[model samples]
Target chain A: MTIAVPTWRNQVSPVLDEAENFTVVEFKGGKQVKSVLINLAGKSQMERIRQLEAIGADVILCGAVSNYYYNLVSARNIKLIPWLRGNVSTVLDAFLSNGLEHKRFIMPGCRRRRRMCRRFGQINKRKE
Target chain B: MAKKRQSTELSDKPRLTNEEVSAILNSIADGVFTVDKDWRITSFNKAAEKITGVPENEAVGEYCCDVFRASICETECALHSTMETGKPVINKAIYIVNSDGEKVPISISTALLKDKDGNIIGGVETFRDLSMVEQLRKELHGKFVFEDIVSKNERMNRIFEILPLIAESDSPVLIEGESGTGKELIATAIHNLSQRRDGTFLRVNCGALPDNLLESELFGYKAGAFTDARKDKPGRFELAGKGTILLDEIGDISPALQVKLLRVLQDGTFEPLGGIKTLKSEARIIASTNRRLSEMVNEGKFRQDLYYRINVVKLEVPPLRERREDIPLLVEHFIGKFNRLKGKDISGIAADVARILINYDYPGNIRELENIIEHAFVLLSGGVISKEYLPDDILHRKSEVTTGAFSNVDDFQKRMILDALRRNNWNRTATAKDLGMHKTTLYRKIRNLGIELPARDGR
Candidate 1:
């Protein structure tokens, strides 16, 4: 599975729409296979969506995505795990371990801590 | 005796009672709340309860993040920052989803709560709902819009004013215009403003299809109505149930089709090609033709009865040449549109390019101008659309070389005045001052040049 994360200073970007670069990580059998950084700053929203689509990203993990960006990203059939804030590898490890539902990774200010668990359940349901 | 004396001394030092503090918080207009170091709500004021739609009693024990649902909660929590840094954040714009799950715009401020010993204990955040302000801004933005059409032209503005009134009634409307004058757009606008807006809006070009095909396309055909007519097919009129159907190029239909259409307009009833039962049409008919139906009627090319039947309410869309003042507005609109579509940030047309556009009498009207801008967008690399990016015909074609004089002094003068007026944003005084002319002279020149001023009727 190819997972895309908009990154800033080696962490999930504070705001998904303003992200300049994305880390596209390909995982197979719960292990990282390939990781590449893709620059998407100064491009339109549609262009950013296209870049993610080009990489065949199955999921996107990011922070503070607006409704407009959410609709655009979701329309491309990619599962967007928004409101995530943490170091890139740490978050990725948590995701791989299915610990993404824990409160430690909840983006600050989000009211529902368990929403991440629901989002993970949805992603798994889609996979099945 | 020592404990009593100590309590008396502490009381004498000055402290607000809980009631006084609550009164102060409730009196202020802004929503205020305090949270402990662990992010649990410690105090929820009356205003906070009102803004968040959660009562103070209910909100006090809950987590502050859960109550606010603020966008900054996940990224830039001012309260969290204040708690960590022991500093205050003032009046930052943020958004929150209320208990009802509606996004609400708000501005917030945060400060750390400290004891007399200067040790941080908790954080307090104050917020104000911006619903009224945001609503005003939305209404202001809507002031420039009419249906899907945007224009500053007086005639178009007049049409915009009366469109809702026209849409309220169920009557046949005849729209006359040169090709590319947006006849179909007006028809659609009418349909959208009417009560039938939620229903389907269909269009059929009478000129594009032959008489037999047009007949079946408008009235439908039954199964085995003719060879290859195996299944019953519904036409544009049938599909437009309780909605609107735009019959474009109505003048070009054959006489046989015209009579049938006249019956539909007059009686709102028609039968399928081979069906025995007659069906009532709940659709409103809007007929449009670039050719003058009045002239066609006089020339015996079009039926007089049909022309009068469809001409119950007529709208003549002014060609772009007649409404040259809208060119810049239309250009800006198209530039913004194409920027989103093509992912390019072309600012606008260059001065020389604007001059050329204003000078060229657009024979093909607004549609042609849109195509020109689209062409420039394709060729332009960045910044703006200069003369170099324009089509070769627009750049090199001269008046005397192909059609007329390349540099007509009068046309240039008119275009310059129009450009100046637009640059000054139709401020007559500023435009006159910038032009180094008297206001009277400017007004006279505007009159002579036929530049339509912005509508004063609250557009």
Candidate 2:
């Protein structure tokens, strides 16, 4: 399977709206076999969609995406794993092992707010 | 502060036992758990229980994926992968459905747990709750309003600030905007704010009527003034006595009528058709046009002196594409408006619907946006407005969205300016520095581009 990750430096770009480069990693037997850098800067959204389709990526992993890009990407049969934040190498490794969930990858403030009262054995009143 | 106190209390306690380790794990704020090679949960922490909405007793001994219900469990197991690759994964972000079936976003980290013998045992995972971030993002969408007008765009906000003041004035206010840019709305606002608001507020579409009819309409016709003049009739000006008269499509008026209108604006006096006696108009004049009157003046289609006479105060409503920030607010406004008018209860618009709306250049401006919402209302039975209900032309307006630039010149320019402003943290100085231009030049570009400077809050 081939995974395309839009990158800034070595990590996934924070926002896909301005992402200009993508690192396509080809995996075989749950391991990275090959990787290539594709720069798609200065391209229209339609052209970018076509380029991604031509790349034949099975999935795209990136950070936050606008609604337009999300709809377009989903319209094509590409699986999108968005709102990810991590080094490209680590993220790819995690993907290969089915371990893409981790603390360092969470975007700020997306954590669930749970009632701590029950756990602490208090009155169980939820935090306001 | 509470967390600090808890940490201090924890430091006072002794450690180095299996039970102590388990207790410490449970006390940690982030959810932590250990999975055996078979993916069975060997240990579950208090934070894990709280985050997953399941008790430790229930979570223990169960398959990690079964307990957490993470989307990756059925497809890609992080612990399973961590076991295969000795390298631990750090800070992988994902979402999982909890006991209540709510999708909770989380960030997780995994590492191989080793015994005292230095042999790999089970894999450990830690995840932090990220609901606050998502909530904050949602909270930031709506909050722009000016009378009935809704917009976050700085230009619109500026116009909003001056709208009341403009309305209070008795001058011949010239409102220039593209079609559907709310020229008539602004004219109404001025009239509503003016002292003459209680009197008859009359509107005449100068372009909708020919020169002869427009002349008779503006200046009352006497009996036998024309073939249709059967009796003495009061024109829009006389009808709008002591009130406000909005001359819509003013640029479409003929030169002869322009001279007559210019005289009225110049001295508030005009002669009724077929009447030798001159009449005085107590009405306030407000002119609106989608055409560039200055260009018309240069083109010789419109009288230059008349343009100068009527353009006492000009309000230029920025096109929708130049003020994309206003799109969300406008969408919300339109949705509410249509909901009341159509008696339909659409909760809101889907993200995709908003995306398509914002991406559109809006050649027809706010009126087009209202029409789009009304169109959605016609098809929307209940629930939210989705892309399925959008007009076919808008849904199929194909353009690459990746660049965030539209084919419309105004849209592309505004996007560029906004992109740069955002990149520079909205600091015009830094933005100018990064753009390799002087600050004043940047300011001019911002003004020319119709980019509004945000309020004091810098939202």
Candidate 3:
């Protein structure tokens, strides 16, 4: 059962009309597609993470991940798919075609330090 | 016992020191009057004469109620209550019908004057006029609600009317305008007015965050989904259930997010970070962009599909220069608002300052106008705001060089008049005929333009 994590960065998630944030799209095979939309009432990043966990989200696909939150979510056994860029549709197509291997997840604190996580198979090429 | 009775007899008749009593009563500035237990006025000082416009000869020994035009002393008087309760009354406001028949506001403070044995003998009451304080309160209340969101232009009025209507709808709305046009304010107004008025109105700057971080922020991740995934998280879509969300600077968002957004539009469903269960939400979307999305699409920078989805309803806010008529109204609103906030008594804007404001093009729109007004209020010396308070940028713009040729409508009209006069060799009749106007009207226009005709020999 391959589940899809809908995100604002990549097109794996369903884009809600009037939805301010990204939501998770569950697809069982190609036919069963159920969407769960989430909006963080507050702008705080910590509150957003907590709300997602409460809703039983398994994976997060995003364009960028802060190290502090990345570590916090990773410690809970949730898969973090980061560094997914492009339009919503293009990202969704990429997710549907290549699955998890094609997606890029950045390590927490990599933004400031420019360090790449070993799990994603990329080394820190950019100087901090 | 006979020696003690002789000492008491000497002390019973204490010496009346007139100078000391007069000095004590005259030293204080508030109206002071002493009334005995029988309510008969015993003493009235200089301050009392100024407050009541009555002299001591007319007030002394008079019944306090009869002198003050009251039916009785203890019925409704604050001073009587203080005397009876033996407690000092402090700053009680009362309306008095003075000798001129005009109602004057006064604050009265009273205390029961006691003798050496601590027995209540009489009451002393002090009252001061509260007309100034009442004026200040009126000014403060005027400053609160009348000042913000200034603009009297028809366009702004129209916007005020439409704002409530837009808020009533649940459809996705796209606000397009130049920077500093209060697009975010319009979005907020819509959220505040809509059925989800009480719900959270989340705003995300699409241009500020990159793709991956933005995605995760929008859609939560599962715990241990990756090495750093600490716990499962819910995204903004789920968090905004039955609430309104604002996608600010939507033009800067990536195309990938656009596709995911399209799916949500197709079906209100999305999956969590690593969870198998699909979540459903009914979050309303509102998007805003200062950049021209259509132009961006043409340049291949933005997605057409996403543009269509967000552009379900579009509202364009015009710049300040385009609505010059609203400048006066906005100026008044800002002045009133800032006056109360800054505790200034600024009455209004100077005519010359208003003229300068109307002429200048506000690149920052309403927000910029508000800032300028606030600055002006702070710098205003007296009740009047002058042009000197305005910033240098507001005074000067890059001067446009005109080659003495016709550029605008006024210039074109001037050029046409000059050409006709020259062609007709300064002949008024011929010039008017050539320009297709009445000779008298042409003469008036020539006078208005201050056109000089060359000297000609009398024929």
Which candidate number would show the highest DockQ if scored against the true structure? 2
Sliding window of 10 residues with minimal summed lDDT for model 1 chain B: B138-147
Candidate with top lDDT is 1
lDDT string for model 1 (B1-459, tens) is 999999789869978889999999999889999988888898888888877766776577666765676767656789978887877899899877554323467999999888778778898999998766754553343211133364546687666656667788999999999999988888887887788888877889999998899999999999999999999998788999999899999999998888899899989989999999898899999999999999999999999999999999999999887776666667766675676566687767765676677666777888889999899889875577777778888666524222332365556557666655543335576556555568899889889878777662101
Model 2's CAPRI class? incorrect
Cα lDDT tens digits for candidate 3, B169-202? 8788999888777677778777766888667667
Order the candidate numbers by DockQ, best to worst. 2, 1, 3
Which one wins by lDDT: 2 or 3? 2
Off by over 4 Å in 3: A1-128, B1-150, B225-229, B272-276, B378-382, B398-459
If the candidates were sorted by their lDDT against the true structure, best first, what order would they fall in?
Answer: 1, 2, 3
lDDT per residue (tens digit) for residues B1-459 in model 2: 999999899878875899889878977899999988777788889988877776787667765654675645533567878888988888788876554333567888899988757788889999998755544442342211124454546676556656666766777889999999888777776776677767877889998998888888889899998888899998888899998888999999988898899889889899999988899999998899999999999999999999998898988989887877667657755664565455677766764565577788788889999899889888876677767788988877635333343546566456545644643336576455544568898789889878987562111
Q: What are the runs in model 2 whose C-alpha is more than 4 Å off? A: A1-128, B1-146, B398-459
Off by over 4 Å in 1: A1-128, B1-147, B396-459
- lDDT of candidate model 1 versus the reference: 0.73
lDDT of 2 by residue, A30-56 (tens): 667889999998875546656877888
